[model samples]
Target: MVKLKIGILGFGYWGKKIYQALRRIPECEITVVCDKRKIPLDNKKIILTDNYKDLLRMNLDGIIIATPNETHFSLAFQFLLKGYNLFVEKPLATSFKEAEKLINLAAKRNLNLFTGHILLYHPLIDTIKKILENKKNLELKIKRTNKVSQINKSEKEIIYDLFPHDIALLLYFFKKEPKIKEIALEKSLVEAHFLIDNEIKISGVWGKGTDKERTITFFVENKKIVFDGLLSVLKLKENGNEKIIKSIDYQLPLSWELSYFLNSLKNKRIKEKIPTLKVMAVLDKIEKLL
Candidate 1:
């Protein structure tokens, strides 16, 4: 059996998770890993280096960039130019222009360019999306709160760091571009209101607090559906009664996301291209608003 040679850049918190997921795929061979700091690994066959350019020499089938947001554009661009498939951790790029360039170049070379929007691959999210389809007059409220220490670890501002997940979810759920009707920032907290397709309303709040919370609430007429990331469960409430709709299994979203990327590479197709671009464009608008 042939194995796909994969090189991963950055071995930080998220990078390590990507490595763990890629390891479980039978068809994937992690050829090289790059990081600024030394990473101790038990596998002697996998190449570990501190420089990313070394990955270029390995003739990798795909390169996953889990580096800082600022480096995503440059590293992905270089790898795409070399005609390797890419799996970039989301926001794809810091700006829409950079994201568009990478996408266009990948299309020109007939390579797969995937963004790691992990939430889209979540089992609970898929279940929620199916329940909300064809429903009108819906309202979405997502509050993503993190500890100050956790927030400090990110190189991006509060908006850039936390807003993309909810925004990506909105785009996926509504299947329409949103208009930023209002935005306000106070210290580390960011609050924004969006109108989607002139029918649905989205209110998003993200920032640093003492506690960490990841909750998504949907109001469809009199029914309410909520997905709690921390608990990995989905619930529905109506007429003052609530019930559990679904509980996710042990499978992690990162594993699902990596599997999708590998499958796309095997099939030689770029799936989710349009939705990824739409998320980037919305992020660009949000950047301009700030």
Candidate 2:
């Protein structure tokens, strides 16, 4: 078996999880781990570096950019130029232009570039997509929150940090980009209401809260299904009866997403354009509402 030599940038929160997931795959080997802050690795086999340029010189098949939002475009562009398949953490880039450039690079070189939209890999989201495929009656409500307002200090606006996960799911189930009906913005919080194909209502709130809640709810024809991260279970309702998809799987979503990207890298067919630009475009519109 040919092990893929993988380099990961950013050893922060999600970056650490990516490291753990990649280690579980027998076909993967962590070539180097880079971050602004020094990170201690238990595996002495993996080289740790603070300078990302050091990674460019390493022999690696692909690099995963798990850095901050503002740094995503530059880091991804750099590695892509060096001829490595890229797994970029979500919200692709801060702007549509940056996203377009990355996509174009991938197209020109035939290298695979994947956005880290972990929610799309959720089994619950997959089941929901099948149930709501092209259905205009569905209503989506998503909220991603922190316990306090001052906690997050990343360069990304709270909306960009959180909403892409929900938006990816929205685009999948609705099969179209929903029009923004209204947007309410604050310094660190945002509420955007969207109408999908002039039918479904999808509303999202991304920001801090006095209480913590990360939930996605879908309503259709007197029935609703909710995947609640807070409760760690999926709730379903229909015909006056209720069912629970008790205790979501323990497997890491990043692992599944990486596995898919690695396997799909060999297939040359481009079914549709990468959705990074679209995600950035929607984010742009939401930012304008601020």
Candidate 3:
């Protein structure tokens, strides 16, 4: 098997997770890792550098950008210009214009551009989509919370840090952009209400609290399906009876997501364009509203 030479930028919280997941993929050869700070790695075969430019010269098959949100555009632009395929962490860019430019550049160069919307790769998403298909008068309520102290200091505001996952799921489930009905922001919390297809209603709450929590609930007709992300379980409720419908397999979502990216590179075909422009557009609207 020919290993794909992959380079990653950023070695912080999420970046480290990407590295760990990539290590599990047999076809991924993580050639170089770049971070501005000193990152200690036990593996001597992998090159570690504080300067990202070192990666530009490695002739890598792809580069993963897990840097700060503000730096996503600049770093991705440089890598795409070098003709390397890119997998940028979510929110693709801070602004719609920047995100569009990156997409256009990748399309022009005939290189794959992927975003790290990890939740979409979760096994439960498929089950949820199947259960909600052809359903009417649906309502989605998602709440994501992180413990205040556990939250990464480098992360942006609540909306930018947590809302992309919710918005991406909304687009995936509805297959269209939702019309923003209202937005409310507080010191540690942000909430938004959306109307999908002028019928299905969506509400999202993101905030920092004492404990980590991630839950998504779908109300379709009279049946209710809820996904408890922390527990990796799905439950169904109907006729006053609730039962666990599905418990996800042992594989982590990050591992699955990275595997998909590497396999797509090997096959030279991408299954879906995640972190789509529509996702960025909704984020733009939310940022402006806030």
Q: All candidates' TM-scores?
A: 0.94, 0.91, 0.92
Q: Cα-based RMSD of the predictions, in order? A: 1.9, 2.4, 2.1
Q: How many backbone clashes does candidate 2 have?
A: 0
* Model 2: ten consecutive residues of lowest lDDT: 265-274
State the RMSD for candidate 1: 1.9
RMSD from true fold, candidate 2: 2.4
lDDT string for model 2 (1-290, tens) is: 88888899999998998888888888888889998897978788999999999988888877889988889899888888888888888878888788899999988887888888877776666777677765666688888877774585332567578778777776776667878898876656677799976678888778876678899888876788888865657888888888995566546556778787666654633232237677778777776665
What does candidate 1's lDDT look like per residue over 1-290, in tens digits?
Answer: 89999999999999998898888888999999999998978799999999898987778889999998888999999988888899999878888899899989998999999988888889998898888889888898988988877635332456556777888888787777889999877667778899977889889778876789999999977888999988889999998999998887545888988998998988998678247788878878887887
Give the residue spans of candidate 1 off by over 4 A.
Answer: 153-156, 239-241
lDDT (C-alpha, whole model) for all candidates: 0.85, 0.78, 0.85
User: How much lDDT does candidate 2 score?
Assistant: 0.78
The TM-score of predicted model 2 comes to 0.91
Ranked by lDDT, the better of candidates 2 and 3 is: 3
Instruction: Itemize residue pairs with steric clashes in candidate 2.
Output: none
